[model samples]
Target: MSSRVLLVGIVRTPRQRWTKAEELEELAELTKTAGGEVVERIIQTRSQPDPATMIGKGKAIEIRELCRRYEIQLVVFEDLLSPTQLRNLEDIIGVRVIDRAAVILDIFALHARTAEAKAQVELAQLEYFKTRLTGLGIEMSRLGGGIGTRGPGETKLEVDRRRIDQRITTLRRELERIEQERQVQRKRRSRLFQIALAGYTNVGKSTLFNRLTAGATVVSDRLFATVDASTRVFKIDKKITALLTDTVGFIRNLPLQLVASFRSTLAEIRDADLILHIADISDPKVEGQIEVVNDTLATIGAGDNPQILVFNKCDKVFDDSLFTRLVARYPSAVFISARTGAGLDILQVRIKEFMEKQMVVKSFTIPAERTELAALVYAGGRIIGERILNGKRQIRIRGFAAELMRIRKEVRKRLL
Candidate 1:
């Protein structure tokens, strides 16, 4: 049975504008993603969120009446709410109340596939619940299906909040172990130029990732399709190799707790040599989405990384005048449609050009028995030219200066 949900969006300040009616539409989509139907939407404007209720007290009373009249099972707030606000709201509404963070967690729980992704989502969920446990303990102990109250942890919600705390601690330790393993693997792949795909949720990052590397990660029109970091290698040119990583998407008002929980996963983007910031060119909120991605990147300490602005979904933008305006604004941006494979060659050329600009050219000669060294260069860097003369192999390789130095050290170590 689809749960009937009432959505609320309270604009705290004029500075925090909500021009994107699409956000409400997207919220409805998200509700559908979690198997809920948005029966009504309530919007309010205020200088600050009401301490007792997220919306104005009058609005809260009205929403309570609406819930009763429409038989709304749950009320979903578009912004993050404090524990106190959540408790007070639930008390008045007499229905399950949840903030945006909890809604995102529910979607993540539904879509989690691999063990690692499942663990990460569970960890995030537990962290979120830890803060809201007090409010939920009384309500969740009685209610079953509602906006924030759905998940595996539903029935055994909190036998004891301390037990949940202990589970979070254990999960963090387990995630740390996994993170250590990932660090080792990252070190091994450090020789390759790493590029990460980043953008607002549902902006075609995974689609482009699949087109670039032929990797079939879950591609969907929904938000946060690719939760876990997925990495694959692609040849930028005959003489240049690059590894591309697809990471979790960013959203407006992203939960800080979720960010903290996924820090290890986001480290891939932070450590990348280049960031491909994909954007949905057709999205009316493209500029706002760009700001959100930039803000999230800054929060994660990846603000200094070089980025290529990729204006994707060009196929959807039919107005040539709008396209021309976008191009004029971002002259160096690459326009593409990952779904239709349009403008991919231009994107590939741009990436290759960036790689070439950063590359250091080197020439080396190795004994015939040292073909292993040449193979390492081909795998770890880019082999531009190679020749076998007498009993030695002469090779020319081009790659990042740091990678070249690392290769030189490895060759000397192996020979010594």
Candidate 2:
């Protein structure tokens, strides 16, 4: 049976002009994604969360009564609660209380597919659980058969903290090794122009990635469908080949532990030649989502990379006037619907133009016998024109100037 859930939202700071009601709606959506049916919502505004309980003590009791009245089985907080506050709140409310971080982790646990993704999620969960391990004995005991408890030593819930710490260290080393392997693969693909799709979760990044490359990456309306980075080589034109990567979606107030744990997975974005910042234009919080993505990029030191703004899900917006206003505000932005293939061709054309502007032109002639040299040029860049004359093959190439220089050197070595 689906768990009956109550959502409690707390804003430590007063709601300013920029605060939107959409954040609370997002929290509700998160609860639903975790297989919880939200029966009640409680919002509290305070200078800071109560020291003893995340919400004020009276508010906690009120929520407890609501839970009892509505038969709520779980209470989800919209903010990350301190370990002390979590335990206190659970004791007062007489029910399991989970914070936003835990909810996000639960969704990740449910959606993780690959070994690397599973490992990364587990590592982040362990780190989060370690912080909240105190007074969680009862909760852990009850969690023997749930989505969050699918880890090693299921029987040892109230075990020594030292063991959990040791496991975290071990996982770190293993992840480091995995990261090194990824670095090697990254270096191998360094010759190709890399474009990474990054934006708020469920903003149609995976959809666009799939459309562009004919990939079957899982695309959903839910948060964080593509957690681990997925890269595919796609031809922009007959002459231009580039690597497109879809990465984990960003969210507001994402756990610091998660960001730290997924550093290796996110390194691809840092190394990318261009970033496609996709936003769900239909979402009411599209501007806030953009800010969150930009903040995450800045945290990862990829803020300086060239970026193209893509407003996706345009088909969902019916008002032409609103669309025109958005376009006027973001003149460089392109609107498209990956699901319906709307404005995709325009997006592709923009990409091609941007790429062309970054390319340099060069000419090379090789003997017909040196077919290998011609092949390298063809694979590495756009052959503007080519011809065979007098037992020699003449070709004109247009691409990244640095790439052409490297190809030229490799071809010369082959001739020698």
lDDT, each prediction: 0.82, 0.82
Q: By summed lDDT, which 10 consecutive residues of candidate 2 come out lowest?
A: 150-159
lDDT of 1 by residue, 1-416 (tens): 88889998876565545553467777888788888988999777787777777686778889999999999988888878888888888887888888778888877767666666666777777778777765653735743445555544323233356587788888788889989998999999988889999999999999999999987988998877778889999877676788999999998877777788788889999999999999999998898799899999999999999999999999898899888888898898999999999999999999888877887889877786887887777765667898898998888987688888887888888888
lDDT of 2 by residue, 34-131 (tens): 67787777677777767788678899899889988999878887777888987888888888887878878777777777777777777888888887
Model 1 earns a TM-score of: 0.91
**Model 1: which ten-residue window has the lowest total lDDT?**
150-159
| RMSD, every candidate, angstroms | 2.8, 3.0
* TM-score of every prediction relative to native: 0.91, 0.91
Displacement of the residue 33 alpha carbon in candidate 2, Å: 0.8
